[model samples]
Target: MKKLLFFFLLMPILIWSQSNFDKAEKLFQAKKYQEAQPLFEEVLKSKPLDIKTMDYLGEIEAHQKSWVKAAEYFKKLKELRPTTADYFYKYGGCLAMRAVEVNRLKALGMVGEMKESFEKAIILDPKHIPARWALIEIYLQLPGILGGSESKAISYSNQLAQLSSVDGYLSRGRIDVYFERYTLAEKNYIKAHEIGKSKITFQKLYNLYLNKLKDPKKARELKQKFES
Candidate 1:
C-alpha cells in the first residue's frame, strides 16, 4: 500500500517536470534564452542530473559572455559526458576568456588546463573545425612561456587547409602578417581571395595593401570591388 501511494505521488511531479522542461526547450529553440533559463533552473532543481538542460544553460551563459559560470556548467557536462568534444571545447574557451580578467599568475596556471581540454577535443574529433580554430588562436596569442608557438599555429593551419582551403589560406595569411612576413601574407591573402571573395577577405587584403605595401591605388580598387 505504501509503495502504491509513493508511486502515485511521484507520478504527478514527474509529469509536471517534463511539462516544464518541454516548454523551456521550446523557448530555448526560439532563442528566448532569458525567458527559458529560469524554467531550466526550475527543472534542474528537481532533477539535478538533467544533462540536456545543463547543456542549454551552459550555452546560454556562454552566449551572454558569463565565462566563469559557463565554464562551471561545461565542466560539469565534461564530467557527465567525458568523451564529448563540444563540451571540452566550450569549457576551454570559457576558461580562456576568463583568463583575461584574472591575475597574470592565475592566468598562466589555467593555460595547461585550457590546452589540455582543447587538445582532448581535437583528439576526440580530428575534423572539428571550432576546436582546431580555437587551438590555432590559442597558440598564436599566448606567449612562449605560456605555450604559444608559431610553429604549432602553422601546423594547425595545415590541418585547416586539408579541412577547408579558404580558412587554411586565411589563417596562414594572418600568421604570416603576425610574423612580419608581409610578402608571404600578401600572397596567401590573394590566394584566399581567389578561392572565396568576401568582405572580410577584401578588407584584409585592402588593409595590407594600404598600410603595409603603401599602395593606395590598389587598396582603393579592392575597396571598390568589395563595395560593388
Candidate 2:
C-alpha cells in the first residue's frame, strides 16, 4: 500500500517533466533555442537516456554556435539510436559548423569535410530539406577550385522551389539577384511575398528592385503593404 501511494505521488513529477519537455520543443520550433536549451538539459538530468533530450540539446547548441559540443551530443544520440534521420541530419550539421569554423587553413580541408557532412545528411535523409538547401548555398558560395558548381546549385534550388516554404523561393530570388538576373529575381520575390510577406521580400521589392524597375507607383503600393 505504501509503494502504491509513493508511485502515485511520483507520477505527477514524471508528468511535469514531460510537460516541460513539450514546452521546450515548442520554444525550439519558434526559434527560441536559448530559452529551450536549459529546459532540455533539465529533462536530460531527470531522464538520462531520453533520446529526445539529446536531440534537442544538439539542435540548441547548433543554434548557439556551440558546434563542437553539438557534435558530441549528436554523436551520442546516433550511438543510442542509429536509425533516426534527424540524428544523422543534426550530427552532419555539427560537422559542417566545425568545417566553417576551421575554414582559415592553408589547405581546403575544412571545405571537403563540410561537403562530406552534408553528403552524409542527404544520404541518411533524402527529404531533409535543410540539407538540400544548405548544399545549394555551399555550391553558390564556394569557388570553382573548391568544388563550386553553379549548375548543381540551380538544380538544388529548383528542387527547393517545389516546396511550399517561402524561404525556398526567397533563396532562389537571392541567387538571381547575385548574378543580375533581375526579371527572374523579381518573379521569385513576388512569389515569396505571396506565400509570406516577410520584411526581406518587401524590402527587396520596394526599396531596391521596385525603384529600379521605374514602378514608383507600385513601389509606393508595396511600401504601404509593408507598413500595414
Question: Clashes in model 1: which pairs?
Answer: none
Residues 67-141, candidate 1: write the lDDT tens digits: 999999999999999989999999999999998989988988898899899999989888877787778888987
Candidate 1 is scored at a TM of: 0.85
lDDT of each: 0.90, 0.78
Query: Which one is best on TM-score?
Result: 1
* TM-score to true structure, per model: 0.85, 0.68
Give the per-residue lDDT of model 2 (tens digit) for 83-180. Answer: 66667667767776677666456225655655665667667766667877677777887788778888888777777767546767877886887677
Question: How close to the true structure is residue 63 of candidate 2, measured as C-alpha lDDT?
Answer: 79
Question: Which regions of candidate 2 are displaced past 4 Å?
Answer: 1-47, 98-100, 165-168, 195-220
Cα displacement (Å) at residue 200, model 2: 5.9
Worst 10 residues of 2 by lDDT: 103-112
RMSD to true structure for each model, in Å: 2.6, 4.9
